[model samples]
Target chain A: MSEAALLVESLAYEYPDGNLALHDVSLRIERGERVALLGPNGSGKTTLVKHLNGILAGNSGSVSVDGVRVDLQNKDSLRRIRSSVGVVFQDPDDQLFMPTVREDVAFGPFNMGARGEELDLVVKDALERVGMWELRDRPPHHLSFGQRRRVAVATVLSMSPKILVLDEPSSNLDPASRRELADILRGLDITLLMVTHDLPYALELCERSLVLAGGHVVADSRTREILRDTDLLSRHRLELPLGFRVD
Target chain B: MIRPNEDPLKHPISDHHHGHDFGERLVLHRHSIVHHLEPQVKILAMFLFIIVCVATPIHFWQAFVVYGLLVLGTILIAQLPLNVVARRSLIELPFVFFAIMMPIFGSGERVEVLGVSLSRLGIESGASILVKGTFGVLCAVCLSATTPAREILRGLERLRLPNLLVQIVSFMIRYVNVVSDEMARMKIARLSRGFEAQGVRSWRFLANVAGALFIRSYERGERVYLAMLSRGYSGKLPDTGHGSAGIRQWAQGLLLPVLALLVLAMTNIWMSR
Candidate 1:
């Protein structure tokens, strides 16, 4: 059988302050799956996502990307896991730290030892994918928020990871930009784990969804069914937009 | 002077959108030989020019004239807007103020002009400082106007600047706007809640705002670090592998400095004669 794209087994994490952020969390995502991670404020969703690529190591249990275990002690394993599981941060300002869009997109592949024409092509392809090729030379600060968001996605996409984990991909975007981003995400064929509070967005993009609250997996089911279940959502402090009906 | 309706914090972004000239501050985004030259080459040449200007004696007024001509010639060649260069060079105003005070306060042989007595030696020294300072400021303005900030940092990197320092400056350039935007938002939030600064009493509140900004920035630094690690950044900054300056490019860039040096040599020789 093919290995799962992302696997977490009995994971638990605690902050440096000794506060438990996650406990006994486990899930397996098959290849080419689009999964939405849903939760309210401070519900360990970010904690779980951080563990996926060893950004935050849990006190117990494990995370494996494409059957390769995330080992903080092993530098090579960490590097491999990092490149395999691309994490696009919530703030484009955080992700696109490089001066120019092209350089920001090239940063990941360049770190991976891609150089010369190969590096140029990688940057070009990534920028083109996001329709930001023409603005590659523009500084990140000069771009509009939506354009910056697209470039942020390109920054990770250039790495061509096995699994792409996005933190609130649709947050703070205007309607047209939202639709455009949705179209771009839909066009790509890869494993996606999106952490979002945008219920309608989840329902539109993801088939399966995982709900975490109070440091545990409160619900794991299909996105449509989960959204339809008001009792299950309200219990975990999830709310859909007013007058929004699930068709 | 902020307008009553205008928040000073919101000025930068709006200024950016309204005028492309204000987007990158000193950078003019022009296409000229000066702009096209390699950054390190430009850096070295400008450095040489400034050094030669500074080394010249104040009595070499003819040399100063030539230097002024050279600067004017460069501005013409670079097609840089004269008003922009003049405005940016206003950064040297403090020195100008000091120079103005020199003739009045300095102790030397007295001279009278327009019913006022001033030290002759002080006048000469003050003029010297003003001339040299103006040239220095103008040269710097020219360089910055031609080259973008990122290229300047890259040039510094290629010139073997410490990677950590270069990275710090790089992050500063990238995040200055973001940080300022955050500060602006915080100020707006405060103002919306009817907070007003009325004197010494407001100093404490402003200090609190600064403290909050510091904490926010610190947290952002951590998040940015994690984001860096997530992208395979392991201590070493990845080299972008931009090509270095060739001999022809170097020769082209050095022409201005070489000419200025020759002018200095001639001025010294003439003075000795």
Candidate 2:
């Protein structure tokens, strides 16, 4: 059988200060599946996402992206995992560090050893996908928050990763920009794992939702079903918008 | 002041509407020949021109005049406004002040000009400093006016500047605005809580703010590093190919410096005769 797009088994992590951030967090995302990771602040969503790209190696268990295991000690495996699992950070400012948007988008593919026409095409395609091709030459500081977010997505998308993980993609966006980003994400064919506190956003974007609380997978079910479970959401500290009906 | 019904994050109180001005202040985007020249050539030409200006003696005032004229002519050709050049040259005001003080305080042979006593040697040396310093500043301003900051960094890289230093400078340029914006937001938050800095008594609060800004910036650096790693950045940054200058382009770019050199040579010949 073909491997799952991402597989995390009994993964656990602890910070340098001995703070146990995640424990026994096992999950599997099939290819092309859109999954929302719902949890309160400090519930280990970011930790899990970091493990997917081998940014933070788990103390125990294992993480595999596109069937390749994430091994921090193995440089080749780490590179392969990073390219296969693109993580779009919450702050665009952190991700888009290049002087111009075009160069920033090309940074990833260039590191992957792409050059000349191949690099140009990858940059062009990524920007076009995010509707940022017109503003390709502008600096990141000049772009609006929504525009920067889209460019941030493109920076990862340029690598053509098998799975795209977004942390708080809908945060700090206006209504129109929020809808626009949703449309863009919906159009993409890659597997997605969005870590968000925006419950409505999760319901709109993902078919499945995983609820994590106190370093554990408390719930994993359909997004609508999870949203409908008010008791479970309150228990996990996940709150929807006031008067947001799940019917 | 928070607007009603508007998302405060969406419309930051310290909105950077003039953020583009930070870059545009130095680089005037235009289709002029000077702006089109390769950045390395422009950088080299500016360095050569400054070197020649420094080498020329103060006695060669005519040569200085010609050098100034050459700069003015290039500014005209580059379509840069005379006022902008003059405004940027105001950065030399402190040096100008020091030069003026030289004539007043020097202990050399005294001379009187319009009821004012000045040392002859001090007058000559002061004039030299004024002329040389002005020429250096003008050349630098002209180079920056024609080339974008990114291009200047690329030029430095091509000129064999150490990769680590270049990356450090590049990151500094990119994050200066971000760090400043973060500070501005923090200030607004403080103001909203009715906090105000009132002289020495407020130093504690201000120091706390500074400390907070430092921590935020440090954390931001870590996140940026992680982002770089995610994109496959190893110890070294990848090279973005920049086309080298052709012979003709080099000749065109070096014209100003070469002309300055000729002016110096002619001044020497005339003085010898």
Candidate 3:
């Protein structure tokens, strides 16, 4: 827990269409910090997290997970990064692609060569964490959107990741499910970096938050401070709910 | 199920349907005899049984009768609806049509029946095709009807089918409905904007929809790949380590094939004698 769990140094990325999705972005997240990435649409939040797990190699600069550099060119390094950092994408439909929820959760640990009771325990524990143990046998398609979202989180949790990188984890969930999910995340012990538009959620869960806009880290400070800054919030096209108070 | 909004009619796009469920197709009717058997054993047994029925000589029409009865017995044990058996066999309709024309097109020894003369060899071939086709289709339908698609994929994995093919099929079963649901939503979106499928102009609009769907699906494929990659996926999906079947389960699965093989062996010997 002493080491910086995730380190992004001077990262920059541009899409194939020549649009810069990330520009000189850099941040350090220590182990056990639940940091929220706050940004408007097209502000490169997704692009930034994709770089953390080596899914999208940056054009310049680097990302390191627990002291090991994330390089897609190196097979061993990429695998190490993937096992250490699990990216929970916005859409559960995309993440939970396996035929059954059990298999989907088993996928990560299974890939890491876990088997038999060990593998079973990993899947069971992960599902139990998200309150989805009963639905393990059910197909991901058969699950409702909220249920699918929870199962999607379990899919990564099964990997026993040191860091959970979620991209818009609360996008399509109902209000109750969203609250339940926030509670679930709060109870977990691992380091969490969640990208979300849910401002109140950010304040409720994360202590420190990073705001990215126009492919750069505009602000990195306390979640409450960022929310209270009406000037910064309005500049980024971010809005708090009507009559909602941070107090 | 908390209603996300007070007025259900005015919901956001986030309320989009996650699944279409593909309707009643893969539903498991519980407590059936065939459902109790392991999927891998059932798969191999059905394949071998179909082969045995197909390999029996056309000269011995009685063997076809016996094979049909065996399939019927298995269907009865499965508790599947009789109409389902018949309706699912519509897959063989084109083959049946071809078999129907066999007597008219081919030249062979002649035989008279009901004021019309047909070639004896052609009639024999047609009957053989019909019997073989029906038995094969019946066996496949039974296997699928008894086992869910997910179990079948697991069974395929156990059978040592190519890993890549198994994965392709597994994903297809999972996402076939999701893709179709996306298409349905796209149709609704267009319809809501005053678009209607009329005569000539509809094709271009439909083509554009297909193009857009292709792009969206391509993007989704990238995301799914990323998800897989994030979960430590290498070139191959690691071994499941859970497909081990017990001896009794194997025996139960193999019972059908062993019986069919016995029938075929007896018929082959009797025909030669």
Candidate 4:
């Protein structure tokens, strides 16, 4: 594996309406590093994640996975980047577009040319990993929000990505589901880029974190260290719930 | 940092939630032979059966009787709910009523029945349409009632239907409920704030709701596409599951349509005399 699993240098993106979503954002995540991308809403976290897979090509700067640059306009590089860097969107419904859970989970693998028994094995392993194997044949919309979220993870996991990026993963999940997902996420051995507002979740699962505000990487340090900085957290619109403190 | 009770053991996302049957009404009588048949075979059989029924000349009235028996027998074999099927087929009521009107407006030779004059050609054409249309609707309802929407889409894809058309139908089946839920929530939000939607002027609000739904759906399309692209979707849906149907399965499914075809032939021969 390359030493620098993901590298973003001075990335800047401006929407068609002239609103800048990301500005001078630089990040480097080493291989096997579990890092949290913490930021407020509209803080360029998602914009930066989109650039990782070349989904959105910024106006300037470059993003590379495993040292190979991601050219958003090039089909071959974009395909390589997307296949290696799997992103699980916040809305499971948006990603789980296939008819059944099995098909949805198998979608990525099959798209990459997996067929028949091999595809079934990939799907089975992914579903079983997420504890959704029993419900593989079920339609996604029939499940609750919590169950669908797990299936969404399986959809990407089946691709066997080298880097997993989750956007707002724990939002709207119940406490039990949240804990369950955190555990599942921690157990996976891969480079993780989690963009989340849940500080407690970030503390539990991610060791390193970068705080983004106004489209810049304002702080990069240990998760615990960032949480201890009360002024930094507050200024970026992040908070710890009552009775909780960073020791 | 403030640590949670680090014991992941306390978190229990039980498997109980999957037990609830959401689409049971759509896939009722799941154990029936008809339910087990391949979706492509079922679709082809239904198409052929309807074609045979519609092509039968009105003079072959006896063929309609046979077609009706074939449908009723299949319904019984499939163990489908008669009342539900009949109620669902009520969608054809307006068209049936239109067929009923054909006798009145149809310009044809006049006939006297019970001291009332009626068009003879109108009676013949109207009755044929009613008989053919009702049976055709019954066959369709039986197919849908037995098959899940998912399998039907897969079946269409397997049968070499244009992938785009099949995908459109698949997305429609998947999100028809989601969009409706959004609309429902919007209505509830409006109602909670004391917006009564009961007047000629209320149509303006309804129009706005429609406009918002369209815009949201358009945006949702983009997100879904991005999601698809993220998963390496390259303008085509991969088909890696669902093998071709067995010959035995096809033979079993074609029995209904084949019997109907035979009825059509018999009626043609008899009416020729």
- Report the number of the highest-DockQ candidate: 1
In candidate 2, the residue pairs with backbone N, CA or C atoms under 3 Å apart (3 or more residues apart, or in different chains) clash, namely: none
lDDT of 4 by residue, A158-196 (tens): 998889999999999999999889888988988999999
Tens-digit lDDT track for model 2 on A164-183? Answer: 99999999999999999999
Clashes of each: 0, 0, 0, 0
lDDT of 4 at B171: 83
Q: After superposition, how far is residue A61 of candidate 3 from its true place, in Å?
A: 2.3
Off by over 4 Å in 4: B1-24
Choose the strongest candidate by lDDT. 2
* lDDT of each residue in B1-273, candidate 3, tens digit only: 443334222222222422235422544476876887778888988988887777778887777778778899999988888887787678688789879888777687778878777878888899889888888888888887788887888888889999999888877778777887787687678769986666666678768877997998889888899899889887686666665778988887778778878887888788889
Local error of candidate 3 at residue B231 (angstroms): 1.2
lDDT preference between candidates 1 and 3, better one: 1
Each prediction's Cα RMSD?
A: 3.0, 5.0, 6.1, 8.4
Locate the minimum summed-lDDT window of 10 residues in model 2 chain B.
B7-16
Off by over 4 Å in 3: B1-24, B198-202
Runs off by more than 4 Å, candidate 2: B1-20
Query: Candidate 2, residues B52-117: lDDT per residue as tens digits?
Result: 999998999899999989888888889998898888788788889889988889887999989999
- Give each candidate's fraction of reference contacts reproduced: 0.92, 0.79, 0.92, 0.83
Write down the TM-score of every candidate: 0.94, 0.94, 0.91, 0.93
Candidate 2 at A15: error in angstroms?
A: 0.8
How much native contact recovery, as a fraction, does model 2 achieve? 0.79
Interface C-alpha RMSD after superposing true interface residues, each candidate, one decimal: 0.9, 0.8, 1.1, 1.0
